[model samples]
Target chain A: MTSTLKIGDVTFSKIPRVLIAKPGLDGHDRGAKYVAKALRDAGMEVIYTGIRQTPEDIAAAAVQEDVDIVGLSLLSGAHNELFPRVVQALKSRGGADIPVFGGGIIPDADFADLKRAGICAIFTPGARIDDIVREIHGILES
Target chain B: MLVRRSLDLNSLASQISGDTVLEGVEPWASRVRALSKALSLLENDPWLATRFLQHPALAKLSTNARVVGLTGLPGAGKSTLTNLIVGRLRKLGKSVAVLAVDPSSTDTGGAVLGDRIRMQDHFCDPQVYIRSMGSRGALGGVSRATRGAIRLIGLLGYDYILVETVGIGQSESEIVSIADTTTLVLMPNSGDDIQLMKAGVLQMADVYVVNKCDLSNPQRMLSELRANSEARGRGNEWTPPVLATSAAEQQGLDEFVDALQKHAEYEHDHPEGRAIKRKRVQTEIATNLLFILEREVQKMVAQVPDAEVNAVQAGQLPAMVVANRLFTEAFAMVQQGKIEKNST
Candidate 1:
């Protein structure tokens, strides 16, 4: 499900930074780590916030790191609550413009709800790394 | 699609200035939001970063925060030691901020910034603020943006600011000018004493820590470090003490911290030490100005006629003559306040 989603009109002369975080009590980090590595390989500065970060922690990190995108990998079924909380946290901190996306074991039924909660895109199981990279490029360029 | 709200410089600055927008009852959360916003602005906008340094609020900010620089080779456990120090400082109720500078990919200008991962133990602590900055094609291990970041963190009321360099040898001397105390972390059995001499790491260190002490005999390295310090006769007053630490095992950190404190105290008590710090700041400001001038000069040169550049390239014109002509024109335009208009 690809759509045009630019982070903002803010231009950066340096490499764009992306903060990939696991924002729930999910011990599974293989997907997060893989995406982080792929993003770094794709020439974006990637700061990986290790697993089990609270929404506040993720938002704070996203701001402090000055990330262009905040990517969350939540394998736990708590995306319904965790995802929106991160978006709310970013918004409260005056970072509403920062693009946020997620990937994990999310159910198809919750896609619209998560989208409504401010997640730009959601990658589920078997999402190819190249496709993810292309999607990120598309989003940033849009 | 996410709702698009335009973020203007004024609103961003207001968010960063700790004004009415951040006057929440919860001090910690509010401070975090304000500081994060300020740093985010500084990181993304070079103009804001420069203006922040010149802002009057910066003069009102406390300069008492000890800026400690940690430098080492790639595998020397600098981040582990930094994490340990952060834990120790937080235990004493002191706030700490870390600026971890990682090397940028020369080809792509990207970085993985994995140092923060090693220091993730403090991720949940509000008192600990860690930001990873890429070297961004700077020759020095630390980037130009670091000094501004340090000043901003100082204004954030942190008691200590630790700057971890890119771990490149020789070029790491830049930290000595910026940090009040520069600690060189080394692992035992890493190399011979000659390598240290060649890197001039001994001359740059205020305190040396032989990390990974549990792995090998550190006494030999320690004694050699001391002897080298003595041979250098650092400033004819203070001799850098070589301590040992096993960061993984969490041993010898107390002595290391004590040594750092003693150095900080010595710098505080001695007038010459203070003068030296002042001198370093003066040099830093001068260097930054020179860098700006160089960039401006490059921009002016880019506007030089291609025929003139080709003439110089083809040896039909002397390079120094062309440079002199360009400098004269640029200098006159500057005097007339027409440089920017002419350049464009």
Candidate 2:
């Protein structure tokens, strides 16, 4: 499977590491686990942080892990309270500019609001696994 | 079913101390490397899917993750938008999971398999979980197993689960079945604006995004959106805001986040709406599960004694009569087991 993907004359077989964390009190993990497997299949490193984390803790972990991308899975309807705190914490920790993306039961009305709060991208459930891998590849390569 | 030693949920939660693996055995930084290695192995392995489903790691996540869904049309720039949003969300100190679904080829019955190729920006990031699913001719343009996978992600304790679909179409309607919110992505120039209004996509719009604002005719598109909104008289109540974004340029992302936050507040204020939505979700799940179980049971019963089936077919007894007899027999067995347990 790794041999199937080559870019610019490079095999590009290494899997990228992504830290998938749960923040606050949201409790939904099936999507996250399936995605983790999908990414792994795509040949990327995946660090899954167990649920109920604060923005500060997540940022610190991202820093410690030296991760290039961070993802939040917010489903408890706390994107408003949690997203900003995560962004602020990341910035304060000198980890600003790291790409942050989120998706979960987020209403269509709230998608824009989340982006404005510093979320780089938003994905709803209808998203394909290939598209996600493509986005992660594009973000890391860029 | 193999029953492993069960760890009490309360005990695990209290004793685990931290979600992170016990320190020292694997340094947090190095653990990222190990995780990457594991992912690579899984990606290259043909049996990856089976092993993943059987992994013990999942048992720990009884509750602690959020699964999200994103659906749109082929050219809706879903890949681009996912990159833009996931990037920002990660920087904000959140671990993200993305399940981007792709359409299967009409000819080969296989997926085009290009999503991972297109999204390269977060390729090496240790914080993002990105995966793709082949529709494989599933109705609604998503895999049926995708729901079970979403449940697994939630149980594993991910903070956010993002499911991005191929794009807006009748098939995209499945997002409503599995996602808390479904985002409909559209381009202004598609000339389907009015169609979108009529097709119920506009009604599904919690946040309507018009991508490619940098184009010369973005405002023209916005005007059309405004006109359409006014025509519907949707502004008097909560108006779904239209945002112009250029995923390629990484523009208007902040405004997008803001809109999501505001809507979250709105949902909180209206519990009735939330309740209605949750009930629908629960019913959908129950209906699917029951349907599958019933089908399997019927199949199994068909192989039972032909004498019993023939007895009913002879018209001497009604079909319902035979069904009732079998049901009662099964019920009696269950009752007998319960009685024995109580006696013990």
Candidate 3:
């Protein structure tokens, strides 16, 4: 784990950059802030787009920051509308291959719909920090 | 199973150089996409990044964009001011790009770039492009990839480029060389006057902004800034103007915009000011060239005999002597036209 993580055949010389954004009008940033800290502690560069960011803002930041992964955290029950828009925007902005994941108050019922919309994975409330980190490694390594 | 697609460097370069295009997307529609891809390539692949930057096509695509560097201490409302400035410039129908550099963690070389949060209102605007860059262990508060990003944005036809450095003080003189006008933002009652003078921060400001004017004691801070500026004795004719603004309240932004316009005009009119700009550009070019040369030298050093390094490590030879020998070998390699071939 101390060695650089490889996404594919290419080995990165620098640390992986992860863009963690809060989409929609969700005022709660405790979750996003915690995850950002976790990723930083995991030896990844994390760019946290502050609260209430539109899908466009998140996508644009993803491309401009050149991040390896985009993590969306939402608590306002607008995940269905906002998360897909972000994935679409990232595709349009030449980041179609970048992995997208989420963690928030997303319902268990919406997991399939979110996955269909191109979300790779989702973490519910009370998820372990080590599990989230392991999920990231598994996703990137795949 | 998840599929992972690797980056295609050749295709990315072709798109950036306009030699190829994705079908169904118009040339203009693909420009931003291509630029984004090129920037990512620049960050990931050093050898390709060097080749892409030194491409002859870049020289042909010249732009007259003005690059403004905004810097201050943390929580000085730089992002707020930047958002206001972007709004003003967009109102005037000018295309703007903002490159916000955030500090990297020294231990992990990671950063949480959150500057885009304050400026998210402009996210949907096609005329405004905002980017957050990590300082990436750069001492000057700006990322090395930023120069390439600026050049790419300029080529994409941006009229103004605003570079917001990690709230840095004093020794970050690299901003002065990178920016056409370097603005130092200060907050009221911050007790920054002594630090400002000690760090030679006063000399770096082409425009001093007292942001959060609605807060306590802005006038006092403004007067202190003015006094310090006057005492420094400028090497040029233009005196940096101290302007006040409350970005949160949206007051004094008009006057701040006017001051920027006037500064631009002054630089255009004065030969001395233009000479200073030229010198800055020269310094930037020299610095980048040295960086490239250093990489080449490192490559040559890697090929040196391990016995030599072991001798130095064992204290059998002075480290400086081994370094000198490596430099001499690197110099010989450079003379043999081997350096040019090393750009893979």
> What is the C-alpha interface RMSD of model 2?
17.0
Off by over 4 Å in 1: A1-14, A76-78, A88-97, B1-7, B22-31, B55-62, B233-236, B328-344
lDDT of residue B69 for candidate 3: 91
| lDDT of prediction 1 | 0.78
lDDT of 1 at A109: 98
Cα displacement (angstroms), candidate 1, residue B253, comes to: 1.2
Q: In terms of docking quality, how is candidate 3 classified?
A: acceptable
Q: Write the per-residue lDDT of candidate 1 for residues B1-344, one digit (tens) a residue.
A: 11122344343344444443643224455555556545655555665455544544344455568999999888799988999999988888899999999887777766788788777778767788889887877867788778878877787678999999998666558888899999999888766778767756557788989999988888888888888878755564677888889987899998888888888888788876788788888988897788568778887788989999999999999989988988888788889997563131
**Chain B TM-score against the true chain B, candidate 1:** 0.88
Off by over 4 Å in 2: A1-142, B1-66, B105-109, B200-202, B223-238, B297-344
CA error at residue B119 for candidate 1, angstroms: 2.2
Candidate 2 DockQ category?
A: incorrect
Give residue B216's error in model 2 in angstroms: 4.8
Error of 3 at B164 (Å): 0.7
Candidates in order have lDDT scores of 0.78, 0.60, 0.79
